[model samples]
Target: MMSRPLATALRDATLLGAALLDVFVHVTSDEPLRMAVALAAASLLLLRRRLPLLTFLLTLPSVLLSDAIFASLAALYTLATITRRRTLLAVCAMAYTLSDMTRWTPSPHLDLWNPSALITLGYTAATAAAPVFLGQLVQARRDLSLRLTEISQARDHERRLSAQAVLAEERAQLAREMHDVVSHQVSLIAVRAGALQVATQDAEAKQAAATIRRLSVQTLNELRHMVNVLRGSHNRPTELTPQPSLTDLRRLIDTSGIDTELTTDLPGDLPPTLQRAVYRTIQEALTNVRKHAPGATADVRACFEGDTVRVTISNTAPTRPALPLPSAHYGLIALHQRAALLGGTVTCGPTPDGGYRLRLELPVKQEP
Candidate 1:
């Protein structure tokens, strides 16, 4: 039945309603035709729910003229469910007004004050209002879904950014550690080579010279490793060698010059990242002292207080600045940044006792 054109069923019922009311009103009293008209009206009524406005117009003439006013009620229901609320309301109101005005012509007078009339008016208003309400409900749900999706996407992006930041920091810390490990060893080699240069009085010194050369080569290899650590260019994860911790500062002291006084309460076996930072801080401070305080005695102190590893380097200040400062001592600036990244700090200045004082402190770990 759905395959048939909707318009056909509506026309049949309208014609039938008109014929039934006409005969009843003494307009056409053919008994056989009246029965057929009533059947056609039933057909249009059934299909009216599928196409409200069309069925209403088709059945309107007969309903308005005779006892068939009841036909419009079903059509109004369909309009409320399927069409826009404004259109449904306007159509229903107009149908009511036209049907009522026909009372001036020989039609049945509709008493607006009657309960039946009020019921019909209420039904029409509900039909129009329902569509607007449902549309609003559906729209609200869609907006909520969109907001949830946006929040989810933002959270995922935030996680990714945090992971990248952590990875970058780890790479930098590894670099600083490798540089300290390699630099300390290199300074020792240079010092030993100077001593060997003075003690040799025979050809046997040639062996000592060779040993020094070997040490220099070992130091060069460490420098290369330090560079690779900073660049972090390895594709394989295992290619990145692990570094020593702050516990290894004893190695640093062993190679260091006279007047070295080590005092550290720093955490033992600290997080690799924080330990690497502390190692670099000491390396830079000592390097600066050796270069700037030539012929002047100094003392080195490293202390661990709670969450921080503090390194202080103090040396008698010279009347003149060091002859060579190696490009404004970029090492000190690098050390400052390393400590800051770890949530620590660094300070370098002239001591009240006329000595250079350097101190650095950095955090133990990233915040959870």
Candidate 2:
């Protein structure tokens, strides 16, 4: 690609050569002086981009003296393209008008009605208007193209940010799921192994059970470390805190500012994984209530109906104004994904009494 200065120099040199040829061909008298003046005016075109006003002013005398048309028009065009300032444009117009008026020789019988005089005036007006008008159009186009490029760049940046945000959210959800599912199962394994280690009579069987219990505990610790690494700095304090089972529900309610009532008909020895899921579901629902409907009373109920367990948490509208909080609105989505993974489903929506309700139902027995 050619550099801009070199390209401009070549263009100006071509226009100058053409203007010199036109002057030499058309005007016959004072060949030496006219050629010198025309050459000087054309040379000024080389500086038009850097010093347009000065070049335009300097070329006016040459245009008037030898009618260096191309050089004069190029200077005017450069001036208009570089600046939209009315004062500068007006100065350029005045200089050109003065040059045209002074250069024209009035006929011996000159009058307002003289055909030659009228023609010269019209030609002068065209010379002044045409180049400047063309230059203004070019300037407008350049400005519009620059604005379009900036707007396109801004939109691309926004798209990249949105994609990063989505990826981060997905990673967080994966971390949460790993913590909920793997941790619960490992804890249950450790508990069962511990019970077996105590109950068994044979020394070999007891040692095997003890090994299983120790490995299960080690696996749970490794799983937590992996989750912490994946979560990075965006993980909440709750994520790092110890997992709470259904038995901790009362303690959770006591810490919450809102009035909450919990009623459970769940069996005491339910699978630990199912208990963890129920606890997480209720926890998420209560968090939503605290965030979206602050000061609202909530009711949490867990019941066993045959082979299924249903956990429902519902909250009334806030008695006080809701607090302002930034929410990603993906909590329910993560909950639904968790339920689906456990061969269950979660339903959430506004209650009939102008409140919110979230219900999670899981099978009594879920494959490990």
* Residue pairs in collision within model 2: none
Give all TM-scores, in the order shown. 0.42, 0.54
Candidate number of the best lDDT: 2
lDDT of every predicted structure (CA atoms): 0.64, 0.82
| lDDT measured at residue 131 in model 1 versus the true structure, 0 to 100 | 42
lDDT per residue as tens, model 2, 1-368:
99998997788778777877767765566667667777788788778889998988888877677666677888899899989896878668767866765674444233548788778877787778788889999999999999999999999999998987887788789889999997999999999999999999999899779877987897798788878866774434334556668788887776655689999999878887788889888888988898889778999999999889999899998877777898998888989998998899999899888899999999977457
* Weakest lDDT window of 10 consecutive positions for candidate 2: 103-112
TM-score of 2: 0.54
Question: Which portions of model 1 miss their true places by more than 4 Å?
Answer: 1-199, 202-215, 224-238, 318-321, 363-368
lDDT per residue for candidate 1 within 1-368, as digits (tens), equals: 45467666666567457545544554344544433443454456666656767776665554444444444544554555465566655656566556534433544555669897777767655643454455445556667788999999999999987886787678677766666776667767867776776777766675656566565765667676756755564333335445768777877765554346677777666787887877777767766776777656666677767666777878886545667655565787897888778787899998876778888876565369
What RMSD does each model have against the real structure? 16.5, 17.8
Query: What overall lDDT, based on C-alpha atoms, would model 2 receive against the true structure?
Result: 0.82
